[model samples]
Target: MRPEDVSALALLLPGVVEAAHQGHPDFRIGGRIFATLWVEEERVVLKLTPGDQEHLLAEAPDLFAPVPGAWGRRGWTNLDLWDADEAVLRDALLAAWRNVAPAALDGD
Candidate 1:
């Protein structure tokens, strides 16, 4: 997957929008960031639950990792675009979206 591919997939989720954040593009829902693209690094950051982050990291170390330090401990994760396909990216993105999405947006 590429940065554009990640952005495309992230925007596919309901109520999602892309915005600039600290020189990078971030995906958000209800004004809260769910994911961010690091174009030059070929990676994306997903705001996930600690459990979800652990599962993904344990399952695919090459594809997922904590963002490092305090943020990572709180469930911020880094995903390597080159190591993931659409299905994997989509699932991860959905999880991130849901993590921050409003209650009314749940279960859809």
Candidate 2:
């Protein structure tokens, strides 16, 4: 999928807002970042659950991975290359919300 497609799907989550700073794209809910992205080099980094990084790596080793440095151990996965469809990203992003955001903040 394209970056635009990812952004579009992310916006579907309630209360999600797109903001850019430090040249990175971030998705926020309740004024907090649920997902952050770096489009340079065609990569989208998602702040995910600590339990999910290994699962994603084991399942889609090539497409999903942990973010480098401190986040790598905490389950932040990066979606490298826009090679997948919106469905995949949607699920991943929702997972991120489930981890970092309160359900109340992500309305209908």
Candidate 3:
């Protein structure tokens, strides 16, 4: 997947918007960031539960890894766009979006 592909998929989620933060492109729902495009690193970061991060990392170490420091401990995962499978990436994005999305907006 490409950076544009990440942005496009993110926008497909309900109430998601693209915004710039700290020089990176971020995706948010209800004003909370759920994902970020780390352009310089050529990766996409997704906010996930630590367990989810661990599972993904274990399952696809080449495509997924922790973001490092406190953020990583808090479940921030960095995905290599060039290495990630589209289906897996979409699932991760949806999960992150749902995690941060307001209840009503999440339709849950």
**TM-score for each candidate, following the candidate numbering:** 0.96, 0.87, 0.94
- Residues 10-95 of candidate 3: C-alpha lDDT, one tens digit per residue: 99998889998898999998789999998767799999999889888898998998988999999999999987778988999998
TM-score-wise, the better of 1 and 3 is 1
User: Which ten-residue region of model 1 has the weakest summed lDDT?
Assistant: 99-108
Question: Candidate 2: TM-score?
Answer: 0.87
lDDT of 1 at 107: 72
Q: Is candidate 1 or candidate 3 better by lDDT?
A: 1
Model 1 bad stretches (over 4 Å): none
By TM-score, highest first, what's the ranking? 1, 3, 2
Best by lDDT: 1
Tens digit per residue, CA lDDT, model 1, 50-96: 99999999988989989989999999999999979888899999989
Ranking by lDDT: 1, 3, 2
lDDT of each: 0.92, 0.77, 0.90
Per model, state how many residue pairs clash.
0, 0, 0
Each candidate: RMSD: 1.0, 2.1, 1.0
